[model samples]
Target: MQILANIIPYFISQVENFSRRERISFAYLSIENVLGFSKSDCILKNDFKINKKDIKSLINIVNQLKKNVPIQYIFEETIFYNLKFKLNKSTLIPRNETEELVKWVLQYKFNSLFDIGTGSGCIPISIAKNSNSIISALDISLDALEIAKINAMYHNVKVDFICDDIFSYIPKRKYDIIISNPPYVLKSEKVFMSKHVLDHEPHSALFVDDSNPIIFYERIIKLSSDYLNDNGMLFFEINEKYSGDIIKILSKYNFVDIELKKDINDRDRMIKAVMK
Candidate 1:
């Protein structure tokens, strides 16, 4: 147990590629999960003794980290838009860009909303927390939908979760807004991604064949005209390299008021359009 005190420095040294802030954040998060301690505990009691069982668990996590597994997946949970969600290999972990998309949707006038590819249900649940609109979330992976359902329960929000591919699922009712953070990464780009993401995350939730990077967008836009009310909005978290291509697709569909947004990192990460 006393050995755990040495683990921090060791972890920081091993994670040299990470910024100091990232190291501290990951260390604190991993420790909290294993030791049930808070950030203050870590700060005020740097030499606090860890139990043997906790040490073993922490060591396992460290080994996983060494293999470039994402820390969020190591812990199996993460906070998105101030809400906690359970995550696993079955779904893509929620990202800040998705949170921004949710914020954009919450600001719009919508009587009912649908989240396409709502892995882990973070986006729709966060929106439901702030707005009174009826929400439904759809995902093709049943395993992902199970995690989403658990997240909805954990957040105490009522959302209709459908386990079906967004491209095939036709909504019986019209929605004023539809949001999605679809799989848009090109397979050719996978070689350039961080090992932490490419190795640990599910491929189905991340990649599209380079030959058809906009496949999901084309299908969604085609079906959206039927499900979206006149003047309804469509929001997407898009691949930055293909933003111009996405705009062309929306234009082809006759969607108006098209806009592209940047994330905090200044990457073109989101797009919005209105059904004309």
Candidate 2:
């Protein structure tokens, strides 16, 4: 049997290539994942005994962390907007900025909504759990849509999961809101990203061509004209570097009431506009 207190230090020592803060955070999360122990429980129950099997699991988690695999993927699940969702390499892990975009989406009421490039169905499922909107989500990858469908079922939320590339998709009906946290990272921006993200997360869900970094945004904006109801709202989780360019695209498409909002990090990471 291993005491919780002793395990933490050992876990920390085994994990590398991360900052001091990250090591501590991962250690706590590893404990929680392996033992169902909270952060406070680690200290309060420092004498908590871990059996051999759990100890092995914790060690495996630490080894994965050392290799820069995200903790969420290790656990195969993550909590977003207070809802638990399954995850895998098939989907990009939901981001805080995307949560902010969902918050902006939840601020208004709409009947029918559609999400473009829904990876794990985090956005629409969270909104569906909170609102009565009829939500439909689209993704090109069947693997991603499979995970998304499972998440919707687990959450007991109804979302029409469509497996289709957004560029070729023709909306069968208009929606009161169309939202997306689509691929906005340019291929050139790969150097600035973390090793864990570049190495683990799905590339097609993350990157756009440097030649047309705003391709997803532009296609969604153009489609919004046909897919959105009169005066319908449109929302996007944007790349901070190209917020101005996205606004210009929206304007060129004749969208009005364009609003750009920052994430918790104060980066220009979200944009909302109205269909005129």
Candidate 3:
């Protein structure tokens, strides 16, 4: 509808923290999702009438946005690595940094792989779709695993999903690769986070104790040698502040060929090591 263009301006006015451009972008995307209209359709049919039901849905979403709800949750789905993933409060939403991790893993060869903390199973599912490797994904949250299972099915890929704490789970067979985008944000950093993330996203999947930020990394590295075949690769999405510290931890565990990589933003966001 011609009036729909006003939706962009209205959201921009209501969202104080986000830039005007960003608010408009969110509104455009939300409208597209609600109306099932392509960019071309929206441009060519500016005068198209919006159904009352669709208008109501759009209004509700915009109201939620005004309250700082994440747009991803507003839609309950998001596109990650060119795949649609169902999202809920139980899991961390897929991010661009995680997409880069998937791309890096796909470039390498592996006989079998395990994804630790596989929220939404995006990393594992994307890798499985591209490679012939047998993949298993682990997450502690059953709700998150449920969404992951649905995503795996939607992508027509079979991934073994397990509900087990990464710290306690022991693998019977050694894997050629282990990948994880684990929770690394420190509790103190909560103050700096947006309300959308702090309030809507699962805190268990997003944070670590500030006193021991590397607890998960320490455990992952300690057990990696047992579960990874010799020369097996360990990949992680790490906190930028502790890239050097994590590399040091891996070195202490005798993980060789350790490498740290930057994300598209040029932040140190990933680390890789080969088990000796």
Model number with the top TM-score = 2
Q: In angstroms, give how far residue 176 of model 2 lies from its true place.
A: 0.3
Task: State candidate 1's TM-score.
Answer: 0.94
Candidate 2: segments with Cα more than 4 A from true spot: none
User: For residues 1-276, what per-residue lDDT tens digits would candidate 1 score against the true structure?
Assistant: 374466677678777757777777788787778777787877777788777887788778777877888888988989999888899999788888888888878777788998888888888889988998889999999999999999889888999999887766788798999888889988888788998888888899999888899999888887887789999999999989889988998999899999999999999999999997
**Higher-TM-score candidate among 1 and 2?**
2
User: How do the candidates rank by TM-score, highest first?
Assistant: 2, 3, 1
Compute the lDDT of residue 139 as modeled in candidate 3.
96
Candidate number achieving the greatest lDDT relative to the actual structure: 2
- Which stretches in model 1 have alpha-carbon errors above 4 Å? 1-5, 16-20
Question: For candidate 2, lDDT tens digit of each residue in 1-276?
Answer: 289998767866777688778888888888887799999998899998889999889888888988999989999899899889999999899987888889899999899999999999999999999999889999999999999999999989999999998989999899999999998888898999999999999999999999998899989999998889999999998888898899998999899999999878878889999997
lDDT of 1: 0.86
Candidate 3, which segments miss by more than 4 Å at Cα? none
Q: TM-score for all predictions?
A: 0.94, 0.96, 0.95
Note the residue pairs that clash in candidate 3: none
lDDT of all predictions, in order shown? Answer: 0.86, 0.90, 0.87
CA displacement after TM-score superposition, residue 3 of candidate 1 (Å): 6.4
